[model samples]
Target: MEHRELGNSGVEVSEIGFGAWVVGTDWWGDRSDEQAVGMVEEALDAGVTYVDTGDVYGHGDSEEIIGKAIDGRRDEVTLSTKIGYDFYDNPQAGHGELPKELNREYLTEAFEASLDRLDTDYVDVLQLHNANVDEVTPEVRDLLREWKESGRVRALGWALGPSIGWLAEGDAAVEYEEFDAVQTVFNLFEQEPGRHFVETIRDSGPDTSVIARVPHSSGLLNEQVTPDTVLEDGDHRSHRPKEWYETGWEKVDAIRFLEDPDHADGTRTMAQAAIRWLLAHDEVASVTPTFRDGDDIAEWSAAADVPPISEAEYDRLEGLYARNFDIDRDDGMDVLRTSVDGEDIEAAGLDKRAASY
Candidate 1:
């Protein structure tokens, strides 16, 4: 694995970070604690130095498993986790909605819990998981300041959101705390928070970095997901529009070199090419996700160097954008619509800007 500077914090981590999302094993499926830990060990052995986990993932089981995996090699890697995206059951009813979990008390409690679960006292990066477009509040602003001041966290960032996490308006990030880093979705098929976001993070200098997650777009960009494939109900890919998720593969099935405007060049596996495109940006700190085994890990990690993509490749991707007007091309990021849309765009469009470039 290669190394990159994570914003201005001066923390250098492997270009490919280990995502603990799969280890969460909540809605997807179950993985034994031993199996999850083994995967973490595999990633670590593969030179993955940055590990990202969340407190709410699998009710913190991910953190606990990771904690056990890196019990002794704490100093060999940089650990990143988030506050927010709480998954507590509602007392009055059966439902859940995105909530602000970065308030001082909530963040503190979350951080402490994450630390305890990870069996670590401090974290390399403490991000507010899935934060939104609200103006900076004293609670979050002060809590982040405190995290740095207290040395419990070395850097700060926003996990963006399910709506903003993978796509967002960096405008909200500006004038905030310099937001040492930002994480979002930037796969080949999903490139709203495109190169511009990466450039902005780079332009921010060493003070800011970008982390790209879901580089595979929850498996749509992968090889196995064909137009005829049907995702089971509990699968994350199942959440996507049934027609598109199952049949959209046709849109990307084009000649490899032809650079079909409707597809991002179907030659190479979109899974690898998609992530490769995101990593091409000099500003992106890293691109990472969970791999089922060592082969996929090796393949996905090196996705950083998937033979140079063509400008035509990007244009093809943009053309794919045309088909999905549901996507909004914002400053430089992409996001899911949280509220109603304007009269013109009609339905909600994604906010794909990560930060201003």
Candidate 2:
């Protein structure tokens, strides 16, 4: 596994990191504690040195499992987890409307709880879980700054959106020098805020990094889910309307050219191709791909070894993005618009009525 530095925090992480959402929640499926812990062990054994989780995942059961999984190997990985949801008040909050607590007291309690759950003294990276631009106030910034300086958190990042509606929030947060990274949904298809975020970070002259989440376009780019693939009722993907699958497959087919082995000297799989496409950019520090088991972990962890796509292919993707793949609809397009001076502006042509990916 190839490792990269996470901005200027002096922390190094594997190119492929493990996303612990599925193992912690029935939102993906019912995964037993044994299976969940084993999967984390498998990922670590396979050289995945970064693990991303949230306190709200499975109502904090995910963090508990991670604590157990890394019992003897705590030093082997850089643990990254999120806070900001007031799960203590309403543990059963829906995915869309989890109430937030940003005051100093709540943040202090949340961080201590997260550390206890992970069995660690300090988190390598702590993020504000899907906070809006307005919610990231001066008070919040000072609180995080104090924590980092005190050695409680080595780095700080802002998770862009709960879905795709918070693009402006992402753009605004990247300008802050205190943040070492920004986690955004950037894959083969949903490159809106990701592209704009990357460009913003570069222009600002900060050593900030971009953590690319949903690097597979929610499984489309990975070729794991086809048009006919049916998700179980409890699966989060099932919440997406039927139209998402239909329209998503069309967009996936449009980018089939990327699957050609010639693009990366024949070593890349469809999934690796999707991840490499994001890593091709200099701003991207890590790609957190969701994994179900050891096989999934091994496949994605090896993507770092695949040769990167040529510059010509990267330019072609840019052109395709500018045209929105001619999909004829505006659902998954990255319509995040901002001012030249880096001020937040309302994005036009964004289909707010459509279900976000």
Candidate 3:
């Protein structure tokens, strides 16, 4: 399961993908569209060829249970979804926040209704769901470059959030160098706006690539929410604020030194060292991680053949996330959500408290 290429969009994907938003959502708990098509056929028998998903998640019923779990293997999967959520005239009040509609005739009738609920004929990454830097206009960037020059999307992204900091809609979709990817909420304890959209796409250039969603910071880098975990009722991490899981379980024990077990390539599971600390970011091509079943999709789709977090454990996780993880306190995400009025979260230095969107 090592794939890769979303940036130079020759379109690969599976370096541990499959976040079907916990398929047809109980917001990540219940499961039973035959256990969500047997947890996406046990993440396609563990090779996990990328799944994603979000046409307002359960509203389109998680792309119709990932089109019945990739019926007849659909060329062994690499799907991906997402379309700005109007939820077709909004009614979903429970998990709230709908109403988005990124123009171009409601994103071409919501990408042909997400290709008729992912029965598919296109879609290997489409994205734009949580869109908001003035809703990516210019006719939604020429209708996403005419659906990737007419193949109907082999790549194109932007899924920033319904929660974490938008960081000016991921720095205006990587400064509009026509994104090849962007999805956010990166892990090893929520690094700001996915390390400020991978350093604003490597100090300003394109080849976007960075699809890491909540790589387990919700479950605290994969200890599955400990400190006597009890987040039950409607658990979208129970709307996060028990001091953000007690300051994320003490920043997951100060990065448990990225868990090892005599690793020349064998034992590594703090959920595969929190997905090898976001694939130690060479622009993080993929790392979806929310697979809540089939033994969490056979231990994180074998975390793409583990053993990667090295460079001296990613420089001791960038000095334990520049010392915040050593546990001082307030990781209750200091009020985020900003847009141009906050001047792109104060030109991305991000001291927080903007909250406008």
Of the candidates shown, which would achieve the greatest TM-score relative to the real structure? Answer: 2
Better of 1 and 2 by lDDT: 2
TM-score of each: 0.80, 0.90, 0.34
**In lDDT terms, how accurate is model 1?**
0.65
Predictions ranked by TM-score, top down? 2, 1, 3
Q: Clash number for model 3?
A: 0
Lowest lDDT sum, 10 consecutive residues, model 2, at: 334-343
Ranking under lDDT, best-scoring first? 3, 2, 1
Local error of candidate 3 at residue 155 (angstroms)? 23
1-357 per-residue lDDT for model 2 (tens digits): 888887788988788888888778876557789999999999999899898898988878999999999998988988999999998997574455578888889988998999999989998999999876767889999999999999989989888767654666666666688888889888877776677777877887657888998898777888778976877765666666666667778877777776675644566777888999998888888899989777788888888777787788788877887676777764534344332223343342343233322
**Predicted structure 2: clash tally:** 1
Comparing 2 and 3 on TM-score, the stronger one = 2
Q: Return the TM-score for candidate 2, rounded to 2 decimals.
A: 0.90
Q: Residue 203 in model 2: shift from native, Å?
A: 1.4
Please give, for residues 1-357, the per-residue lDDT of candidate 3 as tens digits: 778887777888878888887878787777679888888887888888888888888788889888888988988898988888887787887887887878898889888988888888798788898878887878889879888888978888888878877787777777675678888887866678788888878877548888888888778777888888888767778888888888878777767656663447577778888887788788888888888877778888877777777777787778887877678778666676765567777876776667776
331 Cα displacement, candidate 2 (Å): 4.5
lDDT, model 2, position 276? 90
Clashing pairs in 2: 192-334
Maximum-lDDT candidate: 3
Computed on alpha carbons, the lDDT of every model, listed in order, comes to: 0.65, 0.79, 0.80
